[model samples]
Target: MGDDASLTARKAQLRKECLAARDGVGPLRRAMAGTRLYARLMGLRGRTIAGYLPIGSEANPTHAMRVLARDNRICVPVVTARGAPLRFREWWPDCPLEKGAFGVPVPTEGGWRVPDVLILPMVGFDAGGGRLGYGGGYYDRTLAGMGDALAVGFALEAQRVEAIPQERTDITLPYIITDAGVFGADGTV
Candidate 1:
């Protein structure tokens, strides 16, 4: 098979594995415990962070939410329009969030804000630190101007691969939190 075909098959298989793994929150907890992510994230000051609510088998952010809310200004992604960058809305554990377009939750009452730290979810990621979102380019465009924002992708060890298809517009994660450990762009474990 060609590269595209192989990638499609690999993604489908990995998606299934990830979903199963996320179904039980125990792994997420253990992963977070094994890594120094909590300490690192908790250290951020004056940071406006954006974290997405995990859907399907995507990297679960259930645990990260509590730490983030206590440490920094936490925001969530709200889908506004197709082909447009994502608009962020302030989010808290008890905050009322309505299911917006594309079935993702959006804050019911608040204006938008740009993120200083972006915590992204991935279906599959490569050892090269490339990301495969839910086939959306929203994060890529949103991070274009916010170069100062720290980009972090959360995923499972099973989702890590040798490489994934990437476009010129694709943005990479500087840090990745996983069940195994926190990895940098150089594939350091």
Candidate 2:
């Protein structure tokens, strides 16, 4: 085979691997475990927390009922309007939820507020804190203005890239938590 053909084959193989890894249920469970551990380590008790609904390799804490059961205020993002910014609404475990844009679960009606901590999902991330999302830019755009809020991205250890594909608008996560551990300014504590 030619060089181009070999490179193309390699790219295809990587895409297949990523899809398989992202689709597996085991990775989600592991990542969720990592997220819960970090939440406690970060002293997240009683703080307002926001988490996105995971679609792929992104960690999904939705199953961790304990986090919601705790005394913290929980918020989730809802796609209110196209070409508009994301709006986060306060949510509770028992609160009624409806499917918003892209089929992501969200609160139907409420006021928006900034969260003390934001647990984000990513398709890929790196040690330098770079994150590649699902291309919607919702989390990135939403967290951009949150200077005082802790921005954390959750992922499986497998999703860690050597480095993320850089772009002008890409925001760095202050904390990147994987099943193995957490990284960034907090230094894995």
Candidate 3:
């Protein structure tokens, strides 16, 4: 296999393993994780932040989004087109939503806005801030275009791996707030 192909295969295997681990977290643990994440995220205030609706076993950021909305502008990602950077639409706790691209819930009616902070879901990650997302590369493309937007990975601690296979397009996360604790850019709590 060529270098790129080999890397792709390695990442595919790791992604599968990491996702299983995330799913294995029982409801008790998942709830605990959600609580921890809500506490960790409370530190970010008065900023336009993008928080995603949880799909499957992805950690939910609804708690933080709700509280933050009182003081900050909250938005959610909308996949307007395939292979295009995601767009942010204004969101609220009770915003009318319809399943958008990929069956992810998106606001039905809201103006577009740029967020200063994006809370991204991670399929896997490494201590060096390497982020391994689902193969689509949406967050990578979005982050690249989002100048100065702080990217934070939201996941269970089970999602952390020894290393994440790197590609040129992979963007490093400044913070990964998992169930265990908040990890800094260097992967240290």
Candidate 4:
């Protein structure tokens, strides 16, 4: 197999393992973890932050977005097309949402906004902030477009791996927030 094939297989294995671990978490525990993540995220300073709605067993950040929206602008990514960077639109707790690509909820009506911070969902992450995502490359493309935005990953503690296979196009997150605590790109809490 070539490098691309090997990387694809590795990502597939990690995604399955991490997703199972996340799904095993009970509802109460998941809620508690969300609270912890929210607290840690509140420390970051950004006038406009982009977040995502929870899908499946993904860790939810809606709580934090709600609180942040009170004093700051909040936005969510809209999957406009395949093989393209996502477009972000202003979003609030009660903003109307419609199903977008991949059934992800996006704001029904809002102007385009660039965020100073972006909270991305992760399947797995390593000590060096290498992230294993769903392999769509959306976040990576989006980050590449926004050179100044802070890239943060929100995940459960169980999703941490020793290392992740990375390609040249991959973007590493500088910060990761979990139920346990906030971790730096080097994996130090």
**What does candidate 1's lDDT look like per residue over 1-189, in tens digits?**
487777667666766655565565565464663354565577786678888876665665756776778767888888788988888998888788778877776789766778888888776677667887766678888888786888888877766667766667888788888777788888887
Task: Estimate, for each residue in 129-148, the C-alpha lDDT of model 2 and write its tens digit.
Answer: 88776666777777777778
lDDT of each: 0.74, 0.68, 0.88, 0.87
Q: Model 4: how far is 166 from its true place, Å?
A: 0.7
Q: In model 3, which regions exceed 4 Å deviation?
A: none
**Best model per TM-score:** 3
- Cα deviation of 173 in candidate 2 (Å)? 0.7
Q: Write the per-residue lDDT of candidate 3 for residues 4-27, one digit (tens) a residue.
A: 899999999998999999989887
Off by over 4 Å in 2: 1-17, 25-42, 63-65, 185-189
Give the range of the ten consecutive residues with the poorest summed lDDT in model 2: 7-16
Residue 95 shift from truth in candidate 4, angstroms: 1.2
Q: Could you tell me every candidate's TM-score relative to the true structure?
A: 0.82, 0.77, 0.95, 0.94
Quote the lDDT for 130 in model 2: 80
Better of 1 and 3 by TM-score: 3
Q: After superposition, how far is residue 105 of candidate 2 from its true place, in Å?
A: 0.9
Clashing pairs in 1: none
Superior by lDDT: candidate 2 or candidate 3: 3
Name the candidate, 2 or 4, with the larger TM-score value: 4
